[model samples]
Target chain A: MITTSALQVRFGDTTALHPLDLDLPGERIYGLLGRNGAGKTTLLSVLAGFRKPSAGAVLFDGAPVFENVRSTSRICLIRDDGMVGDGTDNLRDVLDMAAMLRPAFDSGYAAELLDRFGLTRKQRLGALSRGQRSAFAIVVGLASRAPLTMFDEAHLGMDAANRQLFHDELLRDYLAHPRTFVLSTHLIEEQSPLFEQVLILHEGRLLLQSDLDELRERGVSVTGPAQVVDDFVYGLKVLSERTLGPTKQVTVFGGLDDERRALAGRYALELGPVAVQDLFIHLTGGVP
Target chain B: MRRFPIARFLLSTHLPFLVMVLAGSYLLVAVILGVAVLVSGPASVSAVDVAGQVLHWLAVGYGYGAPALLATVVVHGRTRREFVAQHPVYQLVAAVVLAALITGVYAAEAALYSAAGWTQAMQPDRPFAAGDYPMIFLANVSMLSIALVTGSFAGVAVYRRDGAGALALVPAAGLLVYGGAVHGFFSLPFAQQGLPMAVTLPAVAAGWVLLWACAREVPLGNRVPA
Candidate 1:
C-alpha cells in the first residue's frame, strides 16, 4: 500500500500541490487525470520518494517512503517530459549502463521492445524521434519491474498504434506479474478501460477518486416531463439539465434505487448511463 | 550479478582519468623538482621541499580537473538521474579512490625523483628510509584528498543551481581558495618549519568530511513520481 497524509509541496511562492491525503492500493492500474499544472507530477514525484514533501509523509507498507532505500528501490517513475540526458553516443551505451546498474533490468525484454518499436539499438537515444524516446522509456519502465510503477504523460508522444501497443504491453506485464501501476494522462476515454480506479486532480486538489465502474454508475440521465425530471432529481445531485420539445434529459450523479426507478417508470422516463469523460468534463466545468 | 558493484562503478567513472593523473603527477614532479633546484639558486632547497612543491602542483591539478570530472557525475538531467538512482554511492567512492590513486601516483614519482637525484640530499645525517616513504605517501595523499574533496563539494553545489557552465567556475575558485589558504600559515617565519603538513592536513580532513556531507545532501528536484 502507498499512502500520503496531509501532503503539501511548494516551490518558492508557487503552490504546486496543497495539503491532500491519498491512498493507492496494490494490484491495480490507476489513471490520474489532470490539467497541465494540476499537480499530477508533484504527487507522482512524492510517491516515488524522489522529492521530499513539505508537510506530510508517504508510507509504503506502513513505512515512510522518503529515503527508505527498500521502498524507493521498488518504485520506478518514468517521467514523460525531458528527463533523459543528451550527451550519450548511442542506445547501446545507455543500455550497457542499465545492464550494469538496474538490478532487475531485463535485457531480453529491452531488446524485444526495441525491436518491436523498430528502434535500432545502434542509434543514440538523443537522436531518436520523440515517439521512439517515449518507447525507450516504456521499455525501461516495464523492464525495471518495480513493485510500484508510475508513468507521467507518457502517451503524448506516442501515435495511435504505439499507444495501443503500450497499453497492451502494460496489461500483459501486469497480469503476468501483479503490481501497482499508476499512470497520468490527459487522453481519458481511450485509456479509461485500463484503470481500476480513476483520480482527477483540478488545480491543486483532488476533485474525484472512485472506481472506474462506480464512477460510470454514479450518475444517471433521465428524460421525461420537466416536472417529472425535477421530481425524480429531488434529493439527488442534479449535475445538469436540458429540454427539447417535451423531452427532458436531467443528469445527476446520484443513485437510482428501486423506488426511484419505479418513480421514473411511472413517469415513462428513460434512464441512460453517464459517460465517465463527459461527467468529468461537467465536474471540471468543461463544456461538453 | 554483483548487486550493483558501487566500487566497480566508481572505478569506471574515474579510472580513465586516473591514468592522466598518474602521468601528470610524474611529469609534474620532474618539472617542479628541476625548477626548484634551478630557481632556489643551487644554494639550498631540500629533497623534502622539492617533494612538497611537486605535491602542491598535483594538488593544483586536482583542484582544476576534479571539479570538471565530478560535474559529469553530479546529475545534469535525465541520464544523470538514472545514473544516481542506479549507482547511488558511486560518486562518493570515486572521490575517495581518485584521491588515493592520485596520492599513489605522486608517491611513485617520489621514488623516481630519488633515483634520478634528490633536489637536496639529506646530507651527512638523515637518509630517506622505508618508513619515511610512507610518510611521504601519506602527505601526498592528504594533499590530493584535500584538493579532490573540496573540488567535489564545490562542483555539486554549483552544478545543481545551474549546469555545466556554473561548474566551470569551481575549478578556478577551488584552486585559488585552497592554494591561498595552504600558503597562508607558511608566510610566518616561525611556522615555516612546520608548514607542509600543517597546510595539507586540516584541509584534507575538512575536505573529506565536506564531500561526504555533499554526497548525502545532493538533491535533484521532484524526480520520483508522487
Candidate 2:
C-alpha cells in the first residue's frame, strides 16, 4: 500500500501540491486525471522519490520511501521525457543498466517489446523520434516489473495504433503480473476503459476518487422538449445543454433519485448515461 | 568492506573511455614530439611533460561527468548514499590508473630520449627528478585525483543550484591552488616534514565531504526537459 499524510510539494513561491492525505491500496490500475498545472506530475515525482516533500510523509508498505533503497527498488516512475537513459547513451546500454539495477527486470521481455515497438538496441536515445521515445519508455516501464509502476504523460507523442498496442500490452501484462499501475494521462476517453478506479485533481487538490462505474453514474443526460427539459433540471446542477429545433438535451451532474426518475417518466423525458469525458469536463469547471 | 555494485558499474563504464582518451593523447603527444625533434634537433623537454596536461583536463572532465551518472544511478533505484559512497572509490581507482599510465609515459619517454642521445630535462618547478618514476606517479596521482574531486564538487553544485552553481568555481579554484602548492612543497628540502600531506589531504578530504553533503538530499530534476 502507498499512503501519504498531509503530503505537500512546493516550488519556490508556488505550492504545486497542497497538503494531501491519500491511501492507495495495492494491485490495481489507477487513472490519475488532472488539468494542466493540477500537480499530477508533482504528486508522481514525490511518490517515485524523485522529489522530497516540502512537508509530510510518503510511505510505501509502511516504510518511508525517500532515499530508502528497499522501497525504491519496488517502485518505478517513467516521466514524459523517458528518464530511463541519457541522450548520448545507446538504447542497449540503458537496458543493460536497467537489467543490472532493476532486480525484476526481464531482458527477454524487454527485447521482445523493443522489437514490437520497432526500436533497435544500437540506436542512441537522442536519435529516436518523440513517438519512438514514448514507446521506448513504455517498454522499460513494462519490463521493469516493479510492484508499483507509474507513467506520467508517457504516451503523449505515440500514434493511435501504438497507443492501442500499449493499452493492449498493459492489460495483458497486468493480468499476468497483477501489480499496481498508476497512469497519469490526458487521453481520458481512450484510456478510461483500462482504469478500475479514477482520481481527479483540480487546482492542486484532489477533486474526487471513485470506482470508474460509480463516477460515471454521477452524470445523466436528459432529453425532452425544450420547456420541459429546463423545468425538469431547474433546481439541479446542469453541466451542459444542447438544442435541436423544438427538442432540448441537458447533462446534469448528480444522479437522479427514484422520485425524480418517476417525475421524469411522467414528463416523458428520456434519461441516458453520460460519457466519462463529459463528466470530467463538467466536474473540472465547465468549459475551459 | 561490502561490494559496492554501483561503484563497480561506474568504474566499468568510465575506465574504457579514459583508456581510449589516454591512447589518443599519447599518440598526439608522440606525433608532436617527433615533429619537434625533426625540426629543432631534439627538444629539451620530455614527451610526458607535454602530455601531462591531458591528465589534468581529463580529471576535470571526469568530475564534470558526475551529474549525468548521478541521474542515471538514482533513476535506476540506487540511493544517493550508495552513489556518494561508491563514487570516491571510482574516482580513486581512475586516478591511480591514470597516474600509473602517465608514469609509464615518462618511462617510455626516458628510454626514447636515451636511445636518441637527447638530454631529457624537466621544468624547474616540477616536484620530482627527471628519472624518479615513483615520485612522478605519486605526484600525478595526487594532482589528478584532487582535480577530479574538485570537478565533481563543482558539477553537483551547478546541478543542484543551476545558475548559482557558478559560484562553486571559487572553491574549485582554491582546491586546485592547494593541489599545485603541494606539488611545489614536494620539491622543497623540508618535504619529508609531512607538511604537504597535512595541508593537501585535508583539502581533498573536505572536497569529498562537501560533495556528499550537497548531493545526498538534492531533488532530482528531469534531465531531459519535457
Top-DockQ candidate index: 2
Give all TM-scores, in the order shown. 0.66, 0.90
Among these predictions, the greatest lDDT belongs to: 2
Where in model 1 is the C-alpha error above 4 Å? A82-86, A219-274, B1-5, B13-147, B159-176, B179-201, B208-219, B222-226
The sequence of per-residue lDDT tens digits that candidate 2 reaches over residues A1-288 is 899999999889999999999999999999999998999999998998888999999999999999998888789898888758878889998898788777888899999999998899999998888889899989999999999999999997899999999999999999999999999999998999999999998889999999999998998999999999999999998888899999999989989999999999999999998677779988888785
Write one digit per residue (lDDT tens) for candidate 1, span B116-175: 554433222111222254443443444444555565555555544545436545543654
lDDT tens string, model 1, A1-288? 899899988877888888899998898999998877999988987787656787887998888776565576677787775233333546765555555555666788878887887788788866777777788778777876778888888765779998999999999999998999999988887888899999999888999999988888987989888877887788887777889987788888867899889878888999988767667877787663
Model 1, global lDDT: 0.64
Candidate 2 lands at a TM-score of 0.90
Q: What is the C-alpha local distance difference test score of each model?
A: 0.64, 0.84
How many clashes (backbone N, Cα, C below 3 Å) per candidate?
A: 9, 0
- Give the per-residue lDDT digits (tens) of candidate 2, residues B1-226: 1257677676777687787788788989899888987898877877777557555666777788788788777777777888888887788788789878888888888999999888778656667778888778877777777878888888888889755377777888788766655554224453333344465567779789878877888788765544
